[model samples]
Target: MSENVRAKAQETLALVDEVNAMVLSDPKAADAVTPLSQADANLGEEIRSRMDEIDMTDTQSIISFGSGAQTELQEISQAMLADVRNKDVGPAGDSLRSIVSTIRGFSVSELDVRRDRSWWEKLLGRAAPFAKFTAQYEKVQLQIDRVTEDLQKHEYTLLKDIKSLDLLYEKTLDFYDELALYIAAGTEKIKGLDEADIPAKEAEIAAAAEQDQVMKAQELRDLRAARDDLERRVHDLKLTRQVTMQSLPSIRLVQENDKSLVTKINSTLVNTVPLWETQLAQAVTIQRSAEAASAVREANDLTNELLTSNAKNLRDSNKVIRQEMERGVFDIEAVKQANADLIGTINESLQIADEGKAKRAKAEEELQKMEKDLRDTLASAKSRRDGVGDTSGTSVPKA
Candidate 1:
């Protein structure tokens, strides 16, 4: 019985260590920003049901222990009476003396050999059968003390296991919450840039141009440039939205798997630990009987099976998380490609705008030069005609 309890304690501690490592290393909790899915909700409900079962099992086990303890006490009492009636008082007294001495070495103050010896002396002179019965009672009491100690230790270990699991669960939830908030805030920021900032800048530029305020050419250029930049930003924001939408499914899948994993851990903590306690308690109750060893073996086997099942579940969940993470990475790459395309488009448009502005300026300069040349030619022609006399002409003829 002691060996079984010790083994269970070690196993519980190992489980605690394993859980701590897993929680600390879990990347999904760190990265998953998506909301929980329907599958996640269903898994949570299933885990809750399993927890309810554990509670019911614990309750029933307590009732069973109470009834079983009572029955065992009566049976032990009957056996003591029979042994007293049939066996030699001297041999029973000697056996009890040895048990008391051993218990005393372990500081079992309740079963004081010295006090028992005095009581035995008195009963020996008066009644040998009663003395035999007293010895048997002392032996049973010692066994009860040992079993009680074992149960207390087991309970303590189980409580530790539950506490560790609860800590892990809280940490996992906190990480996910942080990730969700991060994603939400990013989405809101992009929306504001697209819907609010860009439109406001465009309006400001249009108003400035309409008033025709004698602003510096540089200032006008800056305003127009700011408007163009905002337009590009709006395009970028659209791409971001597209990428986020595309990634949502993968994110949701990862979140679902992560939630399932946490639920599994919770189920192990709530269900497995209590179940082990109950089974060990049952085994302890029968530890003085011929069936003690077999009871312990059965309990161990059941615990091993539960652990194996939990491990398999965790492995499957981990695989889903990895796959979803890979999908998320792919979605991110798609977003990068979209941004690259947007950049190329914006650059090409800017280049075309610059070329158009240059062409219009050159055309205006050429038109002004042609008008000046025509005016010069007309002025020269008039001067030459004025300078030439009305040659010969009319005046001489009139004379």
Candidate 2:
């Protein structure tokens, strides 16, 4: 080697030694960045940790680099909405039916509840009717308690989801750091190859050619090929680093979606839920205002009122049953939604198909464009070696 090349080789070795010393001497730096070889080993281990190591209950989550994170988040949003829906105490639409059911629970008919002197006195004077009503009110109060407890549980669950997002955010930060270390190491490795290894090989190849040392030149070419293979690995590492870059934003998007869901749940817990509870209380107050009339209505016309109510209920029930039975299994609105979803899925599929078709066409065009160049190169090679043999004692067999 020339003095300059020798000096350059020494400098490269010194630089590599300096890097090793830096990593080994500094504990913080050592922890932060693993060497390229060790990083590859770590990556192999990471890939090896598959389903058995993963949480079985993590089915609700999207894996780190997989698809459908947005879709999974959307489903989570829908589930959050569903969790808090129709959470009031009782069925608010059926007041008359509620009152009738309360009255029937006592099993005292119109005649029994009426006031002559003996039966009414034994049944607690005029308060006999209020007994079942008050009992029903107590039952409703218990129902409200149950509903409130359920709401609190859901709130707790949502808060847990928020904490889960925090955990995910922390994990993402770790991933970012890991990816940075990997990219830095890989870039350093590639830089070393480009600056030192390939240049040294090229210099040796040139000196060999000058001396007409064909075997040495051939051996140098093999060394260059080895470097090229390392370059390919570095290229793959860079692509992996790119994927890690993509993972950062994708993880953040997932975190942001989780935050949004938690925000909505918090809003329901902090604002909407209180308002709903107030509305429920006001509704109970209004229902209480109707209880006095409900308590006293059975003197003699109680039987007539009951009969009319029963007949009306029967008629309403029959009409509802007939209308529902005559109706198709699928509602028009449901059918419309299904049609919309189907169209959207088909359109998405077609879009993907078009993209694939375009890619295939482009690939074919490039292949055709290269075909002539490839043929020309082969023809040139054949002409150069037509009657000539390898002067290095390497034989080329007849094709």
Candidate 3:
């Protein structure tokens, strides 16, 4: 894999180098504006004037624009981490679960005897789930509206950034074009001074060496000094060109980064957001189906269990009824208990009668005894009364 990647990289680099060579081979790279005057016209002044004409400020601004876009891309990626999701389907789950639970409220009566809820209760039950669904619909619609608004907002931002990048890309190209021209002109100007102008001036000085040595010496000094100054100016322009050349890759890097950001933002607006919404909607549908399936499955299981339980209960009831029906009207144990209770009652009544007769005999004896004592007492009282009468008569006389 690494080898394959390296091979592909090399192939791409080769194509890039070929294109670079072609772009570098501009037919007008060399300076042709300055005519060769040999000793008259000011070629150095022309080169310096052209160098001043190049506006580096605009170039720097274009590069900064691309860089700023890259920074925005970084910030947007961070924002997207909180924004985009596949699971923000909202409050439908509670409603779906409630509906499922209501469905599962089927009792054993539903399977065996009659219905559990009345017709009115069942009709009213339908109203609750519908209202829950209506509430969920409102909530989900609000979320959809929010998602749509966010998508539109992001779409606007991405479009604006894309246009700015387009402008920046164009400006960068213009900068490279101007830089190439400046570099070419500066290089040719220096070459002309070195190869043609300075040599001619020196040759003129040599040709006048014997005729006016002093004046020629002064002229020579002036020529060399002017040449050095021009060289310095041309060198400064060359350095400027080199600086921009280094900046080429830096500008492209920033442009590429911004392009990456634009791609991502576009995808979020155009594709990912819509796809997430579609999937979220499908998720709600699937959840509803799952809830319904689960509810009915539980109810079905309960019905089966209810039937099994009823069968077992009926078997137990039948066994109890059969046992009772097969039994005799009077068990032997019950008859024996009744006979023993009757004999015990007779014994208790005979014992009560004998005790009553003995009490009556005792009462008669007591009565006879009372009679004899009373007679004797009466006789004694009569004698005492007669005696008391005599004593009272005698006491009245004695006291």
lDDT of 3 by residue, 1-399 (tens): 123433433343443333224222122222322333331345555435554443322433222221222344445435444443432433323333333343344221122111245588677874434334445544554554444444334433433444444444445444544444444444555566678866876777778758686776776576555545555544554454455445545645544554454444344434554554465456456556765777889999999999999999999999999999998999878999998998998988888888888888888898889998788766665666567576553432311
For model 2, residues 33-135, the per-residue Cα lDDT tens digits are: 4444455876544433321222212322212322212344445446545654734433322432443343344322322323344575567755554454455
Q: RMSD, model 3, all Cα superposed?
A: 15.7
Error of 2 at 155 (Å): 4.0
Scanning candidate 2 in windows of ten residues, the lowest lDDT window is: 22-31
Candidate 1, residues 260-320, lDDT tens digits: the string is: 4434333433454445445434433443342445567789999999999999999999999
RMSD of each: 61.4, 61.7, 15.7
Could you tell me every candidate's TM-score relative to the true structure? 0.21, 0.34, 0.48
**Under the 3 Å rule for N, CA and C atoms, how many clashes does model 2 have?**
0
Off by over 4 Å in 3: 1-229, 265-290, 312-339, 379-399
Candidate 2 residue pairs in backbone clash:
none
TM-score winner: 3
